[model samples]
Target: MPWDLRDGEPVIDPAQVRALLREQHPDLAHMPLGEPVRGWDNTMVRLGERLALRLPRHAQAETLLDREAAWLPRLASQLAGLPSGTPHHAIPAIPTPVRTGVPRTGYPFRWAVVPWVEGTPAVHVPLEVRDAYAPNLAATLRGLHQPAPEDAPASAFRGIGLADIEDRFARRWDALAGGLGRERRDQLAEVWRRAVNAAPYAGPRVWLHGDPHPNNTVLAGVGPGPMASSPVLVDFGDLCAGDPASDLGSALLHFSPYGREAFMAAYDAGQVPDPALWARAQGWAVNYALIFAAQSPGEALRPLGRGLLA
Candidate 1:
């Protein structure tokens, strides 16, 4: 039986996914399906060994996968086709959909099957000593921020002008103030103002990962040093074209004190950031910190919000 979406929560299971696959893609339906991994937008399940299925769990989340499916393949191909002499960073493998699924049976949302990537979510691992991963992260961002096509999807919040979202930022900060303590709150306010006042990005729009938090970045084998590991970025639902600062801000949200510095150093080695860009990035970081902190105190992301300021 098709599971219902009760109380706005999507009910999905391995059996439902397998049934859907059998109806639409019968050839591989017999293969074992993995347990569901619930996320903010979709429920992911491993298909066989090398593939994974992603089904939308919310109405808004349904709109993003098509965009991801359409653009990511081209982007991945372009990066792979780069000439040997072209200045590009070592971009970790990005998951690209091999097949796009249509609405069938009781499942109403569009879905996709993509190659599975191997790694542990960065949030579950210790971040304090993974300073070495910062440069790699920076390089990945530098490569991703290349100018996107004119027809690329426009984001209401992701890549738009920072000044446009000032009101939203204020509300989030207001909710976060008391929990953050006076000193930290005051420090955060200053950071926000500096970012809002900084000169805006005047360059052509570039593609962005939209959300680059620790949970989105996956870490592979441990390196020689303690807490060191290879990093792989996942989730392109928030992918859009915009200011590089939007993604840079995530470094603040994900990395520790020294790791943040190392990320900037590595990024600067490839493309030096202007003072204004740095300021704007800091502002973006503040925005994320406030929002995460403002969530219900018991929310899991509250710690991440605290760490952004720390």
Candidate 2:
């Protein structure tokens, strides 16, 4: 039976996915299918050993998947062209789609088959463990933050000036009043204010992973220590072109107070230091934390939201 159905969304099941595969991609139809892993926008099921099927669970996600299909390949090719041993080359992987699935009778949305990246979600890793990879994360973002073409997608909710989202932030802030104490709320409010007042990014619009929260990052490794794990960014559904700070702010989610310092240091060494950019990044952190805290309090990200606020 279909589960977690939203308004105007269709019921998706293993059988339906298999049917889609059989219809569109006959060769892979025989491959084993794993249980569905549902995200906010998409439902993913592992297809055999090498690839996974990414299908939209909601109407809005259909466009997101389309965006990923259209853009990730270009980004991957750009990364591939970088010289080896460069900071950009250090990025382990970007899950570009190998095959695409068009919408058919039952499945109304386009989907994709991408290489199954192996790693533990950064959220599942200990903060101390994640701390080791702070510089790695910095390198990953540095590699990705290139000038985007004019036609590159833009988002109203992200990659824009903090002042633009002031009203949206105010609404989320009000909603958080009941759950957060005065002190914490005030702290967040102050951060948001600074972010809004800070000088906006004057640089060219750069490609952003869009939603680079802890959950979206995968820490791939075998043993312990700093050398063991590498951060692999995933879920480009929110991918867009915007201010690099929009992506840089995610360091707060992946790090503690000390780890954040390391991230900034490494990032600063690579790019020209900008105080306002960091301030705006902090504001973006506040914005993401508020979303986790206010919109999904019952979910796992609530603790993460509070921790970021702290």
Candidate 3:
């Protein structure tokens, strides 16, 4: 497990989940429930070969789970409308829930049965291999960054101005200053300053993945040739609508310098380049880097945070 349950949060076991499925979704009760994999907000257990059950581990994740259940299907439909044989078509799949479960006497949050996407987490894949898929990643973002509806879900921590969360950033920075040392902290401060000073986004709010870090992406074989191992975006817990720069900043987490160039070239092909947007994107990268380092300490993403800062 990569995360711990917060104090007072209940622990859900296989027996309880199985009982819930038997009561609410009998058809799925017979399937084997694999070991649970705990993420920041949810716990996932593989249900047989083709499906997985996603349940919130705590009350705070309940709303996020609801939002994903509401929006992923709609996003999938929009992506499906794209012409075949294009880069958009190359995006293998989104983890749309096939079935949903409601809160019960013991289980207090909603759960969903989503298609089990087969692939390797992008974090485990070498940067060179990830570089090969940068164009596909770019195209996926282009298709996904459509203007969102007026009532779409919004995020306080993402897709908003960096200044809005400046206080939060400062707290995390200061807390980690001793461990990160003066040199690293000073470098990160400069990135944050530039991001806050950059021109605010004047464009419409766009659909954002909200948290598109490498771990949230999966590299699955989609088609033949170079496009075989396409990147599949997953974990819609933080899905929301806000500045496109919020998602664009993830390019720093997903690519090497050469790969980033390829991604930008592919992403900015037709539209006029926005220097402010790119600066803000870098700022978002800084934000995520700090988050990863602060939240996980000496874990896998710590090195990644250092890379992003570099």
Candidate 4:
């Protein structure tokens, strides 16, 4: 199959990735091995050994892949729960492995090879197992904030400002909140504005996952043992270290009130961003959901951005 649907959206062509693997890794010689391990961004496959071939999924991720290529090597000494570092900075631009023999050079968009992690998808794991990971992830964030070796990219910290977040937030609010009563929108905007204008996240910034939602975490389950939430926080593509609140939005930024509660329950004593800053997070989410919402025809889903209006 060339593509698979996720949350009702078509992800990408698996054949595209397979072709990419074949073109780059002639050594494989079309060996019949297994299926394409799936995720939102890249096509992943586990090799025979404890290694895996992770291929980048898009041109945008190239920016992220570039960051990973540079950052992972530095963090490897410090990080304990991730797969190996990304082999190259950009896909197609660099020749790297896809599966065993699949190389990523001479391809269309960005791609790379990363050691496959040993873990199960977090959604498959029980909440009890997932909860155990909160602290480790918190520590992981704490660690990422540690200074890099000085040469990391500018995005290493979330350079986005509260004003930047708010400007985007206002634009999205104008677009989606237009349907709601003006008084309501203005009131919420005022609350969101004050929340943004007043909160304090003054500590020096540090590198962050940009997002740490469940989709990115891997929980391992060995034999009959309970699931292990030894979080493998991959997808360093969005890694930035601005106000820590930019990352906090990933928790409640995308959820409905009820959903946000359930999602937030996972983070015990985690940092909470200001609602206004979160409004900015919503701004980012609005851009995200709009891309897909515009892709086919689901105007309704765009309002989903208003989930941040609170």
TM-score of each: 0.92, 0.91, 0.88, 0.60
- Lowest lDDT 10-residue stretch of candidate 2: 220-229
RMSD of each: 3.1, 2.6, 3.1, 8.3
Model 4 per-residue lDDT at 251: 37
Q: Which scores greater on lDDT, model 1 or model 3? A: 3
For all candidates, what are the clash counts? 0, 0, 0, 10
Best first by TM-score, ranked: 1, 2, 3, 4
Per-residue accuracy of model 4 over 191-243 as CA lDDT, tens digit each: 55555565555556555677655556665555324444356665666765566
lDDT of each: 0.78, 0.81, 0.81, 0.50
Compute the lDDT for candidate 3: 0.81
lDDT of candidate 2 at residue 133, scale 0 to 100 = 85
lDDT, residue 166, candidate 4: 57
**Model 4 segments beyond 4 Å from truth?**
1-33, 37-40, 78-106, 118-120, 123-133, 156-159, 178-191, 199-201, 222-228, 252-310
The residue pairs in collision within model 1 are none
Model 4, residue 223: distance off in Å is 12
Residue-level lDDT tens digits of model 1 in 1-310: 1123446665788888988899888887888899997776788999988899999987777888988899999888866766656564665477888888888767889999988876667777666645667877887887777788898777887877788999898777676676766887788788888888889999998888888877788776554352354667788888889888988997667777788888888777746668888888988988887767666655555678877765
Candidate 3: minimum summed lDDT over ten consecutive residues — where? 220-229
